[model samples]
Target chain A: MHCLNVELGERSYPIIIGSQLLGDAQHLLPYIRGKQVCVVTNETVAPLYLSRVLEALSEFDKVDTIELPDGEAFKTLDTVNRIFDLLLERRHNRSTTLIALGGGVVGDMTGFAAACYQRGVDFVQIPTTLLAQVDSSVGGKTGVNHPLGKNMIGAFYQPRVVIADMDTLATLPEREFSAGIAEVIKYGLICDEPFFCWLEDNISRLMARDPQALAYAVDRSCRDKAAVVAEDERESGRRAILNFGHTFGHAIEAVQGYGNWLHGEAVAAGMVMAAELSHLRGSIEAGLVERVRALLEAARLPTAAPQGMTTEAFLDAMAVDKKVMDGRLRLVLLRALGDAQIIDDTPRELIEQALQTCGAT
Target chain B: MHCLNVELGERSYPIIIGSQLLGDAQHLLPYIRGKQVCVVTNETVAPLYLSRVLEALSEFDKVDTIELPDGEAFKTLDTVNRIFDLLLERRHNRSTTLIALGGGVVGDMTGFAAACYQRGVDFVQIPTTLLAQVDSSVGGKTGVNHPLGKNMIGAFYQPRVVIADMDTLATLPEREFSAGIAEVIKYGLICDEPFFCWLEDNISRLMARDPQALAYAVDRSCRDKAAVVAEDERESGRRAILNFGHTFGHAIEAVQGYGNWLHGEAVAAGMVMAAELSHLRGSIEAGLVERVRALLEAARLPTAAPQGMTTEAFLDAMAVDKKVMDGRLRLVLLRALGDAQIIDDTPRELIEQALQTCGAT
Candidate 1:
């Protein structure tokens, strides 16, 4: 098992990445308090990963499970209440630790449930999908979606530990895997030029599920994410760079209806557009934008925004996003393939031109 | 104005207490970042306090207001979502500061909405009711109610500042005034002896709307709570003592329905039962219990559990609280009238004896 520390003092925790590490939970026993355990999962991932986790967690005295409907809409206040129902049914308390055992949807919802159930409770992440294992599992952003905005409601509460089992990805769909690769590529594009070049060369090996290549990709992505999150856990400044394509991406997901387009896919396309826009505005060289388009196309991720989504609607949606600062559009622009900067005073003409290029017209 | 610092370091903010301070929002002005401000209040408190707050914050380029239905039942996820709806409608971004203007219920729901709206936004507390002015306004315990548990879904996001307008108490009903007094006395009974003695001598003056007495009560209670909360912001240790009679109090509030009994009224009775229970277990002297009983009775608050509530119902209700440390019953019992301690392993007999003495079957 490889342990990566997030290093934020007391709020810090370790990310355990390895194959079949679900059984390595005994080493994690010290951090857990109370005698009860409640595992929170969802419909899609439960049948595939729940039993493996249950078998592994059999050492704990009492454990209960609450399975939720599988979708972005399910990440709502109602779902949070359902977890409360499970916690009350099992009589879980402050000391009781909750286990989030699924993808970003379940991790976000479960982490939120843990945050709200009796003010807050300690919860562990056993992320099943590639997207969750690489990203959502580490950041302490716990919350449900409001009708108006995706993840509009949440808290910056870290998990007790993150157990990222790469073996679980065997059950992930091809489309989902492609979507996750988009985020995996995000780490390379943002902070690691060598890793970006490595990804450009190894996209097929990572896609073909070459165990070593996939493992390396996941670990590197998590490490990069963990480092940024540790320095600016709550998106104060440096952390905003981590949301490279999320502002426009959230607009696509919300306007397109969540679950229709995968989050990473939307973000992949959005980043290409952001890079293209930056190139036009002289922030980054045109060659870098072409490289981004080439990389995303290689991963079989979307490089174009969803059709029929109007530029006005897209702007309206992006305006409501938590990321937009001071009435100015805060767009994460690529200075180069491996270097990024979040520009708050993004020019309206540049944004409009990018939207038109991405078919948001 | 009286500045009460909560002492959470950088996250720490001041609670400004006085009459008509809402008219001069200079303290709140420094915390305002963006040009937009969204004031969250309820239908009831809006007509009374909203205009003053609006006038004070008129300097903001764009200001909006969302008035929700008043009452405990209104403290639901639905109401929290309504704030999100208004925020999205106004295109309020991350820098938009939410000002919670009303009683405890409004402050909690607004603060909770602010906590979740686009992950989080800057918020100010314009708490009008006496209960809010003293307690919920200062602490960042923001959340809405779940069907099973009170404050079932929420976060610990502190406001930029808390503006408590004591003059708003003029419009509060007699019942509401009495309810607010329950928490005021709690600070004394749990942590401060001199304050407890002072409360005994001044309860009538407070009830009579003596401004000086009211100011002293709010300041002292907030001061006591501020220190404990700084040590354990999310109720890890010393903060639990602040919940002296809250276990029983919340049970009564939940079982009887949230608005059926005023929170403070229920807490007033709960404190008496807790004192008696402490005596039953030999943790507190009977005379001290009587002194608590006398203060509650003098305030026209119930001293025993309500008429139709059965011990089984109470126990079932208590089991769902966030304070149930584990499967075991955790009670904040008085080591004396002027101090309290959390007993994690309370014997069933002592609980039964206290319930029986409180006239419950």
Candidate 2:
């Protein structure tokens, strides 16, 4: 078991990463402020782990469950309203605690619901997927995607605690596991060269779902993400770095239609486009771009934006991304491997060049 | 002009209560951080003042207006989403500032939109109605209502500045002007005997729309609310006192359907019921109950819950109120005419009697 603190002062919470931790209720009790507990999960995860979580929470005075339809397509305000309906129907109050017990989509929706329910309520995250455990669940960035844009509406609501049970990942699909690696690789390129190199060396073991390697990767990614989030909880300045390829990545997800490419796959490809832009700008060596592509390709993730998405479409979608500062197309580009910075001065033609090169014929 | 601070530490904001201050864009310039501005207002308020506000914001690099349908019925998540759609469509970013230019419904939806847009953005409240200028616009409470409950979804996001222009209240309907007084009178009932006496002495003048009397009432009410909010921003303790009559009041609003009875009208009746409950508990003299009824009646506000609402219905609705603690229906009851305390041990029979007597057949 590994416990990492996000260090956000009064809002600081622990991220617990371990195998076979689903049944560990003792560690979760402190975060549950009220007797009433509502666990929100997706259909896919509920069948696999609902009973185990319910059994773990059996000691609570009251426990309930609401299972949402699985997948990124369901991550919308309407779905969030369903969670609110169940909570209100059950007469849940500010004191009630909501448990988000699925991957990123469930976690984001539940956290947002908790943030808005009765103004705000206590909620804990039980991330079941590698993508969530390493990336989304740690930071207090909880929101739902809009039809027009990915994660267009959300709140920076921190959870009371995050319990990432690695055992749940054993049931995750192979493609989803690879998508999670896209975010895992992000930490390496953005700030951690050593971890990036380690990922390159251990890509096959991670691909094989080696438990020890997964644990190490999850722990490292969380530490790095948590550090960035702690420094800038609201993404005012330093936190924008965390969305390294997300400007392009979110555009990809929105353009290709959410749930088609998967968040990690889109980010995997988005990272390549950003790295290529950096190389073109003379900030990084071409070898670094190849390495990033090589790593994503090894994980079976997309290395380029989807076909039929023109440069104009990418530009249009990217303009709506949250990272577009002061109406300018600001993006996170690598100064070098393991180093990223937000740049808004990139020429429009260069952006078009990168978009055209990355898009399919 | 009366300048009052809500005293929420760094989140504390100023409430500027004055006559004809809406056109003075200098006072609004500092709160607006971004070059882009989106002013959210309701249909009722737009034709009357939107042009003036637009004129005030003419200096911004870009300014947009979204006028929503008016009334409490429109205060839903769906209506709030319309604001989000406009923001996303317009490419409003994190630095963008949103200004809410209307009564409670518009203020609330706009505030919630600002709270969720790019996680959050700065917003200024240009409260038009008497109800909003005195009550909802002061503290940083922002949210939309759900089908099950009033303000079931919301956030405690403070505004950058609140511009409560008395000039706007001139166009308010007589009922809304009286409704705003309900919250103003509450200040005296909960904590200030002098203010209660002042309201009694000046109710007619306030009803007549005497600018000075309105100014004094709005200033005093804001001062009382700001002090309480500063002490307990999240309502864990002292802040709950502000909802003294709201426990009964919100139930009335929900049962009768939102907008049927203005928020303050329901609260007026609920305050009377609460006073009756206090009388039954021997927490206060019988004269206090009569005084509350008399004040509400003098303001021409309802002193009884709407017809057809049974005790069971009220209990069920109140049970879902945000104030319900540990599954118990905790209530804010008067210890004296000018003092209130939260009591959970009030007998069920007394509560039933209060509801039965105050609710019409």
The best candidate by TM-score is: 2
Tens-digit lDDT string for candidate 2 (B271-344): 99899999899899988889899989999999997878788888878888888888788888999878989898
What's the lDDT for candidate 2?
0.88
| lDDT (Cα, tens digit) per residue for candidate 1, span B247-338 | 88899999899899989988988888798888988887888988888887777788888898888888889887877665677889988767
**lDDT of each candidate versus the true structure:** 0.84, 0.88
What would the TM-scores of all predictions be? Answer: 0.96, 0.98
Worst 10 residues of 2 chain B by lDDT: B352-361
Chain B structural similarity (TM-score) per candidate: 0.98, 0.98
What residue runs in model 1 are displaced by over 4 Å at the alpha carbon?
A359-361
